[model samples]
Target: MGTNTRRALTVAAWIVVVAIGVMLSIQRFRDAVGSDIGTDLRTFVAAAEHIRNGRSPYTEFGYVYSPLVAWLLLPFPDFDAAVGPWTAASIAALWGAVAAVTATFWRALSWWQRPVLAGVGIVTALYSALLSLDLWLGQTDTFLPLVAALAVFFASRNRQIASGVSLAFGAIIKSWPVGLGLWMFRRGVQQRGRLIAATVGTGAAFLLLALVIHGPQMFSEWIDRTLVLSEQDLVAYSVWGAGRHLFTQSAALEPLFVAPIVGTIVSWTLAAFIVALIVITLRRPGDDALSMWNIATAVVLLIPVCHLWYFVLALPLLWTWVAHALKGTRRLESLIAVAVMAVWWVIVFRLPPLDNQFGESTPQYIAVVGSSLVALTLSVVLSARRDADRAVVVREAVPA
Candidate 1:
């Protein structure tokens, strides 16, 4: 294609992406700010009310977010009153994450590839269906993922302090992004310790502020709300939780409800398998992008209660795949991987959401939550071989 043709296509792609985005997002936006039930935004508003009334925010069950988030909501005393501004802020943060990450990777790309990265980012964000689901449900994990994405992106580029500070803020917001430690510490790589120490310092300082304002017991209460209570039942959006929900519970699609012991063993085994994959991948610092994507995906899927809204976290991961595939040395393999990912995402995006126990079974629920993960893993595994080949070539060229 001629340069003019290519430019035209790029312009066309942007217009198409924006048009589709507006078309798809209107109802979701309306649903979000219009007193939607089943939204975490209600819980957030209640938490804010607790704070305003001098009650502990944690006393509002399901208001298990950082005290900082509650503090942010202090102005919005009611859900109907607060949902509009909150949704706007959440969507802004969601796409702001995409734009920041695009800038980060675009800095390294050739001129032609810059447009490719932006296009990939736009498509990935829309395809994620996260905006639709998160907005509909009044979810607020959007901004935390943005911070976490920056942490992992910086960590990949060897910017330890920046990544650590981003992570500290992320932990303060929701606490799941701290799992990016796997990428920061691969094989005890140089600066791994630095990242950890930076995260500790910043996390402690920010956390201390929350403690002082919310009372020293704030830390313990945060932990219980975030982790302990969720541990008692099946988490809707996780591997183990999904397994339990699918086969062990009598809810959605549960025909053969297995014995509790059987479900326990199977769920643990799947979770352990994912742990093993992460451990093996982290054994050596390979592709920072791939590992970051996989690790973040795993953290969301494997956490004690990996809520589906958290899959919005995968927006950066998706962008990374497109960028890596288009620019990597092994074009054919990367193309194949990207193609598989694209098809899967489109299908996931179009399929009706799996709505049981509050829409936890959807495709965006972790690559629709399961097979989509395998597709992502395939992208990494295929790309890892290329990294290995390049490393070998560099070693061969070295003077002994």
Candidate 2:
């Protein structure tokens, strides 16, 4: 194909992709406008109203985010009127995240394989039950994964300061991402110092601004209301939540423990194991797609109550897996593995998460939390092997 034709085709492909996204999410748009859902947006708007009236946003029942978020949305006083546009903006942010990944691997694939990956992206979006649920509820967190993109692309590109500030900005929005600072601190002394100073300085500024609005007590109130203990949620969506189900005397599975307390202790141990795997398996000189996914997914899973929208943070890892199939050395086998994994994932999550009944729906919940972790790890391991093989060839080629 000629250059002009290829350019036109690329533009057309993206347009179709965008149109499909809007069509799939239109019902969600209506649901938000009709007040069928969007409690989160309403909460933010309500919080902003409180601030406008010289009150704390924590006064609103569901306003659990940082005071800075409420301060940011103060322009929209009437939430019912704001829901439609806000949902549209949420959809746009998700598209931007996908675009970022596509751009990352654009130069590697052949022209035909490029469109195949676009199809892969479509499948990814469709299979993401949590992402669909996120849209349906008008969640604002669709924008969080963009920070993961920045972290992946900017970390080793002589842009450590920019990466650190972007991550700090994410924490200012949601707070869970503070856990990602672990990898940030693993760089060499100069880079680590820039990252730490940038993150701390940015976060301190966010808290100081909120202090002026709601006083220091506001953060404490936000933490109390926002952070629930894992044991408290009867049916959670975390790894610990799956562990809890194994000990219950349910029809699907026999109780593994005689008492609920035994189950609680066992589940906490399981969660701790998951955390260690994520932290320990991540290699240093860390700024790759797999490392970024490891840290981000670990942060999300560690949450006491992992919600559907929160998994939006992990989409980058899924995208990376698909990208690796096209970009990794064992293209044929890696492609098949990820293709099967992606389809199996979709089947597991096909039904409404809270209402499903395949092995008490425990498998579904656990797999959703664990699948990306497994996928990314396998990809990273295989990628390392491929690199080692190439190094051997290069060494043998040198004078000896």
Candidate 3:
């Protein structure tokens, strides 16, 4: 078959897979949207409503995100009835926007690659599966990925100024996306000017929006709320917390601090691996598309407090990696990434109760931490190979 025909088949197969995955998730999706999403949405609604009533939303209400994020939610009424449907629609719209933006970036690729890219997009769109949960709960995690993806996509395209702005805006809304700035800086001086412009413009825009929406006092309140949230112990809510809880209750593990410390070590190690990958990519030439996607995915995965939805950013790269891996020239590194995703899916779906009397045991920690290590190691090795290939290409193209 012609390459084009083969590519078409690949895309058709990807669409079928995505459709099935979504179909399987329908019941879970409904349950999530039907339940309370999270306190963040409630807080957002209350704050916006308070502002509409001439009360300072930031001061009287609790809000940790940037003013622009809250302002975006202001158009909807404060009542539960209004917030429910509005939040759902907003999330769905954001998901669609992110997918569209991703597609735009992939439009220039070869016909065969496009199908793989589409598969990546679909996987990215569903990476968190938690977004469906958030949708059910009427939450904003759905919009988070959209903002982050746009920021990275724009930045990679040399629209540094816009990219910076998007990054700043996303950061204001949720602090985690700021990590993209680290990736941006690591991208070097090739597009620094645009990056600076975008960062400053976006930051200024957000500040101005804050001033208009809640007056100057809003900034102080935002700072205060952020500090409070930052200090709150996450032990009971996160992977580490769940692991610790499980080990203590179920197994006879003695050192209580071991689980959290081990988890922290694993998380930071993964982060360092990602940073190294980015540094290597920066030193090489060619593979710009893959390099950009790799950096974005690594940054998202490396963040300490990553939730299930955070994985959405990794989906595009994961798809690309898998497509390349399955094409018969397997990279041990890519296979590891695939393994990590599989393990992650199992853990997320089977999460233990936060307050379950049984503590997280050594076995559970081993499973999670071991999987993370394998994934990170694979990422590093695969990234090295990718960089090596690019170097060879560049060298070969140089004049004798």
Q: TM-score: which candidate is best? A: 1
| Runs off by more than 4 Å, candidate 3 | 1-29, 60-62, 82-129, 155-162, 236-309, 323-336, 349-366
Q: What would the per-residue lDDT of candidate 2 be over residues 1-400, giving only the tens digit for each residue?
A: 8999988887787677666766766754565566556667778888889889988888887766778677767777687677767777776666666766666667777665566566566546544565556765666677787765665556646477777787787777776777777657442334667777777888888788778757888878888877643234345456655556666664433444556777778668767766665645353322255566656766776776566567667666667667767776667756765765565356433556554222455566556656744654554455455545656777999998
* Leading candidate by lDDT: 1
Worst 10 residues of 3 by lDDT: 350-359
Q: Which ten residues in a row have the lowest lDDT in candidate 2?
A: 279-288
What's each prediction's clash count?
A: 2, 0, 21
| RMSD vs true structure, all candidates | 3.5, 4.0, 5.1
> On residues 1-400, what C-alpha lDDT tens digit does candidate 3 reach at each position?
9888887787787677567446534544455546655455677777777767787666544576665555666787754554556554544544454454545456455555555545544544544444554554454555555665666577557676666776665566676666556545543346777777777677777778668756888777777776666533332323343344333432323334445656566445545665676677555412433554555555655544444455445444444455455543445755666667566545543444122222244455345444544544455467567667756777999999
RMSD (Cα, Å) of model 1: 3.5
TM-score of each: 0.85, 0.82, 0.73
How does candidate 2 score on lDDT?
A: 0.64
Is candidate 1 or 2 superior in TM-score? 1
